[model samples]
Target: MDRTAHGLTSLRNGVKTLPLAPMRDNSEIRTLIDRVLPVVDEWREHLTVSIGRATELTGLKDTQIRYFEELYRQDRDPAASSGVTRSYSLTDLRRLAVFAELLKEGYRPAQAAEIVRSFADAIDYGAAYTVADALRREGDAITDGFLLSRLASQVIFAAQREIGERLPDARIIAMFLVERRIDGVSAEEFVDIARDIATHPQNVLVAVDRAAVIGNESDSSESVWSDDESSIVLFYSRDPWSVPVPDRAQFCYYRPPSTPDATVVFMVESAGYRSIPPELTVKTSARDHLLDWMVRMCLSIFPEFRQATRAHNYRYRSDGYRLAHTRQSLTRLMHRVRDLIFGDDADVSVACLLLPDDLYKPMYLSILAHAGYPEARARQARLMLYGEGEGLSGRAFNAREPFLTLDAEQDLRVFGAQDERCKVALAAPLLSHWDTHPFGVLYLASQRPASPLWSETAFVALVFGNILSELLGRWWLTRLRRKHDNLLHRYVAEYIRWFNGMDMHGPEFNEGLQQIERIWERIAVTSASSGNVRTVVERLSRQYVTLVVLDIDRSRQLHSRGDEPFLLAAQRHVHQAIAQILPDVRGYWFKNDHTLLVLDGYAPEEAIVLIRRIAGRVQMVPVVIEGRTERTTVTISAALKSLSYQELYDLSHHDREVLRSSLMTIIDTIYEQTRGCERTIKVFQHGVWEKV
Candidate 1:
């Protein structure tokens, strides 16, 4: 998935990799006037012309056209406007021209006007609500940092949000400009895969969900994405092979006539597939600007923002405090957090924190980064979720200094973890920016008791700890920058979602997404905490996502009552319960306390059914608390938020901002409603909470 983000296509069978198009300058304004305007006649209804030009087309004086309009209006037929602009269209002029012809044939002005109204039946008017208008409007309205032609930008925007409205999956479109062949599948087999997905989608570009990352999660190979065609698109080039095209394919070969050796795309009915007219089609008689536009959009998204937002090259694993080890996507400084945190020094009794908020604070430690270590010590240091001032790591973080204890076994401060078996322990603070708050501590304990080399080892650990701190500072900066860049991508998507059916050729059209991204890049060019893309996407869309929170009621109290084992067992049961209920619904677990499930493509009713099923499982499964068997219902909070459009929303801040807000509101409602108890199932719908 390295190249998968921002529509950068993954290399697969018969997939040719070409550098995508860059964002073009204001010269793009000419694209509409020169190419699409003259060619895409459907664009004419959305596009408007001046009155002087209308007069020229109709061969009538301005006064005469006004007189005809007045006569029609007196009979309650006023000329229509383009909505944005009150200007007339070529259709109006053509209608006028036809009316003048009738007048020459001795018909009254009212009769001529009535005759002009049936011009579509009399003349060849183009398709309405074509994909071209969507493309043209999205492209023209969004003119900044956008290079792909109006056609391409809209295509990319439409690829999922609009076009996917008709599609079966959230397929990512990757453009190919060169002829290539599928390595294993023959042309015929390729058709079968597209027609039926009978074989693995390895032959196409599919984007598997993070759930697809399980079991084989450690395998970060691009091949894993082939499991689902729901989000992959292998865009082909024009006339590249003799393979028969699959009906209703997610992708089609496209090459604009402006390219040097651009040959006509043989069978691609890019626009016709959608029942749009030929002139308003993507592979219309005229098309290069569209190629540019698609490339622009697929460019890691203005992919120059890749220049502005340099974190795209790194896979994100840190959002919402997710941990990473060797090969997991983390900060560049700790490109391999496992090396020092869980690396070669594995045998030396090393323990690292889990879920460090901004510095790995507020959590526990694990010494065995891998399995099959000494079972006794492994169990001892398995996990000790403690308070901020409890563990030696927390002590170092709070005091802002390294801690070294030569006699670790008898040190009461060391806690009774198996690591206390060691004679010496060293702990150092993993520093944060400005040293405001230290988040995590890196701790080490010796396997041997009271060795003379312990002092020197402590000093070396202190020195290396500071070095890691400096690297983490850089890592934090990179993260915030990446966060902002990601927000921009969301804003672009949000604005387009709202603008899909709107007129782009109208006056007063503001390129909100483009302008915002441009201003954000310019303004926050250096700040760690920059602009909020969430705030900008607020009014653009009311995204439809169901937020579900499942937690063990009174988890903190249960943990304090020596119910750690109970809570852990409950988590396993909940995980099993979900797998049994709706295995395909991907849910993200947080801090082992609660599970955050953002359900996309699932109805609120189905999600509630799932919650009830999970509640049944937790209530049915007995756990030993205080050596007594008891079953308790878990606390479940669920809400379904609806949007006006279709979007492939995921679990990233990009799509989760609104969900996050609603999640907070959901939690808040539970706090107020369940003041008397800890367990309850609450669903927020139609602005009311339903308790089950």
Candidate 2:
């Protein structure tokens, strides 16, 4: 169904392109699927078509085709000057089909032939077949026209629903029926003409002249309606299909999604987003072929339309379906990769992704998903397969590249500890554009090492890994967007109600503004344009704080001893240590070297003992740094301060400032004092320091 979505990547966005809006059932209209499919399949076939073949192509006899071709010099077949039994080419066939469509629309042979000649270049064979398909599907319904009331409601509702009335100005709409431009007609006139010409089914397109209305064009090589003569133009066969250069990256043609083979497209120019009574916009239906054509037109010719749809992709639809859609998409790709890499032995092979626990401090990957492994083995692997620098998965993850081992048991990278049945293995790091380095590892192991070519490995590493990362990243972004939206509604909605035409400069109003800003600051994941979450509210109240900061001492020294990964592992080790030492205290990660623990109602004496205990525990953690296991020391800097309402405005920054001035050097000295000279660190009432 050509669900590529003009490259929107529906895989991540989760809006399944709906079925091609079908035409209403019509018994009298002969079915043309067989004929249409053949013409569509041979759309580009350059071979000459015989007079007999041409008759079949257009459902017209030789006499009518000859009369039309001879009468219209513009759509006449190329000059061959062949014998008496004259032949026709594919172009001749398209012209004849178009002419036949026109004739069926109650146009006399002369008028129909004239159109085929005048707009010879404007008509496409794709349009002819599309018109045929529409005719056999819609019957005489379109000729019936729509009531002004229903049409008005559909237009108004769909526009505000899809675009939320964001576009400026009232857009004017026009329709091109065959070669006639039905421009700027009244509501009654529009409906009357629509039904008057509805005798034959036509392939329609809603063309929007973006340049006429839209401002601030985006940086995209999208196709513009070079032939735009109105604000919003509709084209059809019995119709005119706009010329689109599909081979070029920039072109206006948009093929029907229902019939992918129909290359002819009608374009809609979203002319600065106009207004009319509005055109009915229910593009969803088996019988909604006309409105569906409108949708395809805009998406194809206008980048702004595509942008609008992409921007609103998940609002309500994504929140409900994105997770399952993303998971299914990812899983299908994994299974395909497995089949590509393993073939007949795929059932006995294993391919799994290992998402690491933490990026730094303790670097290790766990099996996030797997195939071929029994449930028990998959669980076991999930728990302990890739530990520290233990397996091929770890090797790939740590190296941030692809790793391959022809023999797993004999390879030292496998660590001789797991996946006993696997004889060969391969792993590649999955890279994320959002992250600084690899986000996860794609691991593959087999019961027997099948000889796979380098191309296969490269395919898995490059294509599979990239697609996985894209889907995962998009899914994550969707989730984050949903969270951010919810936060805005929940935290800012109440504050907005107090903002009527109240005093412009009153203290109460200013205070209300401050309160709203503070609420946003505290709750927003994305703040003002910055995407840093400083304080996450676990409990909300006018609670007091005992802010304690812990730092990994001389963290750079670990980098000199081991790779950067080892340095990260060292940080993780320290974080885990601090977490265990003060299990009851809530600590926030503040970079590789520090953890900020905020305690409520803890006395100065309690803060002193807690920091010392954290420092001691962190110093004793056996951190794996640069391939070596060693104990690393940490520096404890602290504060025992209470916050008034105003002080909590920039909570994290305020806490850090207090920690910076808390005499960290003296605190360190006390934690490291010799046995007999041990001293205590304390904060007195009213937030003062005391050394005891």
Candidate 3:
């Protein structure tokens, strides 16, 4: 007889003899030992069994056995000879058994393979040490029915039970099948039924009414079964040799009360089983079902559909409904993505959206959500965009790409020095919609160093970053428009107040008002011509302007210091200090060590006095350069220029030429007086000024 046919024949013969044996404990032990010992002996010495024996033992077909062997071979070390004929060891047989069992339980081959691989190492170790030693130690007494069953349970079901324990979904399904077995069926027989279901095609037995069976068989209807109205159809394969089928037909199997629930067991070609329906034939896995549900959920929230709804004017609901729906959909998507990537036990310390300000500094980050941290601690979290060169978020922003560190303490250069909370850190740049350069970063941190979120959350975060960018962009545009409108409104209101303040009924009031209107028109024209509002406004508001020349004393000392970095920093500090004192004053760096300060609404003498006070303050404050404090004073020289509305209005058309000539004369006299003087205070009065 053909080996393949012989293996099938042997399996059939074994099934036939199962019922013929008497129900004595000794007989049961003798029966199991008779079936199992020979197979054990074959693998005991060399730790391997022939493919045919493995096929018969696992109840897997020849092709299925070959496929599993191929998978095992791929997992083996590449150094091993590929030309060697295929063989199965105690380890290989256990994995094969699991793979076959899952297949029989309606899992697709790929799904079964993935699940089996998860526990394959554990199963191999258990088989080698636990089962092999037990078989050798027990010897002939293994035939004692109880001892035989116990050994079988330990060796055969140990890995499966461990797998079930690790995965709650699998445990629930196993418990349902075990608890719902027919009355009088022994635990051993029920286990045999489960094994058989795993090895053969079976009828799917969904409840006729899911509501009626709720909370009875499974915790929830969605757990083990899917339902549709009119009839709760069970999906199954008609041919015993074929793969488990997708949900297509209502297949029912009739069994006596003495038989296990056909809903949970395979339909065997025996006296107790009768198949009733036969159209279901293609295979699907739990993962496939989940993917299908995810697809449906994603499709329901299509952008086109949402856009159409947002554009439509509905009488029943306000426009806010669209925003509410978008938020709801995004929340759902976040939850789903989290669940898929992190599993149930993941702890996400924080999720933040980092944005850049107009200065290109990452000043702060907006917290989206966080877990495993107290509300106070979460609220206290601060992210500095600039000068945070040592952190993962900073690195991501600088690099304009994603960054991940599994063990932040050991792997990261920044953040780890001061922070003990972060174990895993991941950051992905949030790019602008119009450009490839990143405008912000999406940051995530976790206490669990080994969490998969570091690797798995990058792509999803990129997608989310793009979505957030689009949303924030829309909000910013609206805010800018509102600000522009408000600025215009304020300008109009100020103009009206200036017009209304005039005494219209007084003598020459009309002429004065007409002159003011022309001045206003000149101011507007100058503002438009120069593209400077502050310049035009100042010229309109002030009759006189103070020009103060500030010369840093011994500034050449900085060049002699020979430390470029320190010198640059010290210069910046001085400039910043001066600007801080008079924030509204327009100033320019006329030279490396000199600044020209332009002040409106001050006379030359008053400006000179003010400049002296500012100079004293600048000398009093010391600047730190490379850990050393250094003090520097400024020499002050002031000049006053009259810039009345009438004068400005007349000069408006000659704008640059007249203003340049007037400014040059004032600047020249002050520069000449302050040329070689240090700590000098002088005021220009009637073209020539005296030193004070």
Local lDDT at 59 for model 1: 69
In model 1, the Cα lDDT at residue 20 comes to 32
- 395 Cα displacement, candidate 3 (Å): 3.3
Using TM-score as the yardstick, the better of models 1 and 2 is 2
Residue ranges of candidate 2 with Cα displaced over 4 Å? 1-117, 120-321, 356-369, 383-390, 411-420, 433-437, 453-464, 494-692
Better of 1 and 2 by lDDT: 2
- Tell me the whole-model lDDT of each prediction, alpha carbons only: 0.42, 0.45, 0.44
The alpha-carbon lDDT assigned to residue 17 of candidate 2 equals 34
Q: Which tens-of-lDDT digit does each residue in 1-692 have in candidate 1?
A: 12322322223234544433222232332221222222223335446666676766556787878777764452322565444333666656545665666566565555455444433333335223358745654454244222222223234333333333443343333322221322344455533433332122211211222222332233323131122211112221111122333344333333333342321111222333343211113422112354444443444333222122121122111111112322133223232332444345435543443223333233444431322235355434523445445666666766677788877877766755463466666677766643565534557665555443266766766666667556445444444433433333324432232233133211111222222223233323322253665653452234334556566667666542322245544555576677778787544444344555555445666667777877777667654332233454444333333222122222222433554444455434433543344556666667676765
lDDT of 3 by residue, 1-692 (tens): 11231121112213321112112243332323233333333344557777788788788887887666554344544666987656777767767776776666565554455445545554454323347544543442222222222221221122222233333232111111112324455545654554555444322111111222222332231121122111111112222222222222112112212322422222222122333222111122322232233223322322222222221221011101122233345445545555555565444554555444321234554333333345455445555555544367666666667787776767654453235476767777766643344555666666665666745477778788787767645433433433333332323332232333222222222333233344446565666687666776676665555556666666555443221233344444555566767777644444444455666556555676667666766666665443233443333333333344534454434555555455455455555666666777767555566666
In the range 1-692, model 2's lDDT, one tens digit per residue, is 13232221112124453333222232221222222323433444647767887777678888887677656644333565546456666666666766776567565665555545545554443223356645643332222121211232222223322333334433322222123334455656754454333323233323223232233232221111111112222222322233321221111122334545433212123444343332333333322443345344433432222222221211101121133233345556667777888888787776677665533343555554556656565544532334345677676665566777776777777733354577777777777743345667787777766646245676657677887776555544544444433333232322232222123233332333343334435533333345333433322233334545444555545453443244345445655666686676444433334444555555556666767776666555566543234544444343343343223444444353443333233223322332122222344355444543
TM-score of each: 0.31, 0.32, 0.27
